[model samples]
Target: MRRKLAAGNWKMNGSLSAMAEVQALCEAHPEPKVDMLLCPPATLIWPMASMRGEHPLAVGAQDCHPEDKGAHTGDIAAPMLREAGATAVIVGHSERRADHGESSETVRAKAEAAHRAGLLAVVCVGETLEEREAGRALEVVGEQLAASLPPGSTGETVVVAYEPVWAIGTGKVAGTEEIGEMHGFLREALRKSHPEAADAIRLLYGGSVKGSNAAEIFAVPDVDGALVGGASLTAEQFSPIVTALEGA
Candidate 1:
């Protein structure tokens, strides 16, 4: 069975002071029934990982360079992140695609790099508001998922997060039906390539996930967990969501 995961993305936020939340979160669920992950900004990965102690909390990186090493001045490669105590890295987040003009192929390359570095790649796929309005949400995400995933993806090495572009950080979440449809479709799509491992792969829903609505969202079929945003910055705000997933 796929273990439920409560993953948080701090994005460009958090600092050394903010590490308190990580300690508090770990203390709150030292023996949580489900998995917990926190993807802090690259600067905090080492400190956050170090502070976790014997807790089950896993620290991750928000993004990583596709190449193992190069002349890239501002890019941190997957291996570098792994050395900094990160066990996973998020790829293809909408912000990277929009702000950095990253393509699906670039995302695929980064996922491959993550695997080469022995890190789990949390590959993200989502449709923008315009695409959803144009009735191409499924089509858009399907293509992105197919192209963004690495060729040898497996349940242990990859985690797929479905975060609608418009819903992220907007206090708006896709309806349960919408989430279910996309997650089910994603599972079917994963099966086409990794039929034996598709069912073992954990599918996470993202975009405006919080304590207030987490349980309801978790009730949706095929939603193995969530990739939380704003609410994850604090233990009080995030613990409830983790508890909800534990009971899911």
Candidate 2:
């Protein structure tokens, strides 16, 4: 069976003082049954990973450069993230796609880079409100999955997160049915290209995920866990969500 994961993305938020929550979170779930990950901004990866101590909490980075080494001014290479203590990195987040105009091909290259540097790539895909309302949600996400996943992707190297563009950070969430449909679609899509590892690959739902609705969301078939946003900022908020998944 695939192990469930609770991955937090700190986005552009958090500073040195925010490390307090990391301590509280690790202390709260010293021996959590499910996998726990926190992808803070690049600035905190080293500090957060160091502070994790012997806790099961894994630290990750928000993004990385597609190349191992380059003259790219503001870009970080995957190897650097690995050296900085991050074992995983997120790519193709909707925010990046919108704000930076990243394409699926770029995401795939980044995923390949993550693999080359021995980091798990948490690839994200989602449909905008217009696409969803037009009933093209599945089609859009499916295309993204096909193009964004790296050539050698497997369960060990990749995790897929489906976050509806309309819902992210908007205090909205896809209904359980909607989440279930997209996750199921993503799994089948993964099988097409990764037949051998499809079942092992975990599919996570993201979008305003919190304690109040985590249990119900976890109940959905094919939903291995979540890629939490704002709610993951604190132990008091995230702990309950983690507890809900452990019970699921």
Candidate 3:
């Protein structure tokens, strides 16, 4: 069976003071039943990882450069993230895709770099509101999934996150039926190429996930967990979501 995961994307938020939340999270779930991960900003990765030493909580980075080193000003490389004590890194998040104009090919290369640095790649794929309205949500996500993941991806090296663009940070969330359908479709798509790793791969749903709706969302089929946004900033808000995933 695939292990359930509860991951938080702090996005561009948080500072050294925010590390207290990580402490609270670790204290609340000293021995959590589900895997827990937090992807903080580049500045907070090392501090958070250090504070989490020997704890069940794992730390990750929001993004990374494809190259291992050299000449990429203002860019952090995958290896650099690993060196900062990050065990995983998020790639192709909607903000990155929209704001930086990151294409699927670029995401794929970054994932490859994450793999080379021995870090798990949390590859994000989703559809915009227009695509959904046009009945092309599946088509858009399918294309992103196909092109954003690197070749030879396995369950251990990769995790897929589906975050509908319209829902992220807008206090909106895809309904259970919508989430389930897309997750199931992603499973089938992964099975086509990585048949051996498909079943083992955990699929996470993102976009405005919170403690209140977490249980219902987790109940959806093939939804192994979530990629939480704003709600993840504090233990009080995020712990309940983790509890929901544990019960799921």
Candidate 4:
């Protein structure tokens, strides 16, 4: 079976000492059955990567540039993140899309950069409320998935995250059926583009995923895991989601 993962994205929140919660989380539930990751802000990448947790917890970066070195001001490279001990880097998050106006092709180049640096690329895709209401949700998501993923992508090098734009950080979630459709569609989309990676690659759902609904949300077919937000702020908030993942 493909590995299930429960990754927490701290987004723009967290202090220098905030990462200690991950260590507490490990002790609270050591040896998690599913994989786990904490993608903090770029500034915390090195500190969290070097952290010694009671259980293994991979470190991640919120974003990176396609080039190893660039004239781009304030942009970090994927290799820099890898050298800092980060295992993965999130690409094309809705926040990045909205805040930075990143394009799908830009995200693909960033993913390629991560692969070149030997880091996993968590590429994100989603649709807005307007798109969803207009019934263009699937089309938008599928387009993003295709254009945002570069050629030669594989399961080991990249993971797909489905975060419905309308739900992320909004205390809302896509219904199970909708989640299933999007993820399942993405699975096939990747299969068509990279057949060898179809069964092995993991597809994660992100967007207001919390303790009360994590288990059921995770149980949805084609939903291999989640990219948790808000709740990831504390062990108290994030632990239950991990517990639900473990129990699942």
Candidate 5:
């Protein structure tokens, strides 16, 4: 069975003072039923990982370089993230795609790099408002899923997150039917490409996910969990969502 995961993405946010939330979350869920992961900015990975000592919670990085080591300035490698106590890394987030112009091929390469470093790659794919409005949401997301994923990805090594561009950070959560349709489509797409690994792969939904709406989102079929934003910055906001997933 696929274990439900509640992941938090503190995108471009958090500082040393914010590490307290990690401790609070760990304290609140000493024996959590669902898998938990918190991906902070690269600067906080080590510190947050250090704070997680014996907790079941896992620490991850927001992004990683495709190459293990390179002369690329301001780029952190997958191995470096692993060395810094990260067991997973998020790749192909919308922000990276928009701000950095990362293509599916680049995302695929980064996922491979994460695997090479023994870190689970939480790859993301989504459709923009324009694509959805044009009735090409599925087409856009399908192509992304096919091209962004690397070969040999299994439930253990990879996780997929779908975050609609219009919904992310915009507080506009997709309706249950909309979410279910996309997730089901993603499952079918995965089945065709990686038949053996399809059913086992965990599919996560991301986009302004908060405690208030988390349970409803989790109720959708094939939605293994969520890659939460804003609300994940504090235990007060994030713990409830984690608890909801545990019940899901």
Candidate 6:
């Protein structure tokens, strides 16, 4: 079975003092049934990772460079992230696409880089609000999954996160049936490319996920877990999301 995870994307937020949240999250619940990971800003990963080693909590990086090391200014490569104590890294977030103009090929290269560095890669793919309204959400997401995934892809090296471009950080969520359809399509797509990946790769939903609505969204047929947002910054808010998943 795919391990259920409540991965948090701090997303351009947090500072030295903000590490308190990470500590609290770790302290509040040490033996969670589902997995818990936090993807904080690059600057804080190492310090936060030192908080504890035995809990289910793991520190992750928000982004990573495709190249191991280079003259690329303002880029943190996978090896650098690994050195910083991150067990995983998020790549291809919509913000990266909009702000840095990252493409499918670049994300694929980054995913490969993560694999090479032994860091779990959580690859994000989704359609923008316009595409959803235009009836091309699935098509856009499919193209992304096809073109961006690394060659020889398997469940072990990757995790897929589906976050609608519009819904992310907008307090909006894909409806239950819509989520089921998208995740189901993703499962079939993965199987078509790598039949052995069945029931291995965890599929996570992101974008405005919170305790109030987590269970409803997670209960969908193919919804394995979530990549939490604002709610995950705190233990009180994030725990309920995990707790809900258990009951679901």
lDDT, candidates in the order shown:
0.95, 0.94, 0.95, 0.89, 0.95, 0.88
Instruction: Give the per-residue Cα lDDT of candidate 5 at 222.
Output: 100
Off by over 4 Å in 1: none
Model 6, span 22-92: residue lDDT tens: 77777777787888889989998988888766776889998898999989998889999999999999999
| Candidate 2 ranges beyond 4 A from true positions | none
Task: List model 2 lDDT by residue over 40-110, tens digit each.
Answer: 99999999999888898989999999999979999999999999999999999999999999999999999
lDDT of 3 at 208: 93
Off by over 4 Å in 3: none
The candidate with the higher TM-score, 1 or 4, is 1
Which of the predicted structures, 2 or 5, would earn the higher lDDT when compared with the native?
5
Q: What TM-score, over all chains together, does every model reach?
A: 0.99, 0.99, 0.99, 0.97, 0.99, 0.97
* Backbone atom clashes (below 3 Å) for every candidate: 0, 0, 0, 0, 0, 0
lDDT score of residue 118 within candidate 6: 94
Q: Which ten residues in a row have the lowest lDDT in candidate 4?
A: 46-55
Worst 10 residues of 2 by lDDT: 183-192
Residue 116 miss distance in model 6 (angstroms): 0.3
Model 6: lDDT equals: 0.88
Q: Model 4: per-residue lDDT, tens digit, 67-179?
A: 99979998899999999889999999999999989999999999999999999999999999999999999899989988998788878898999999899989989999999
Better of 5 and 6 by lDDT: 5
Compared with the true structure, the alpha-carbon lDDT of candidate 4 equals 0.89
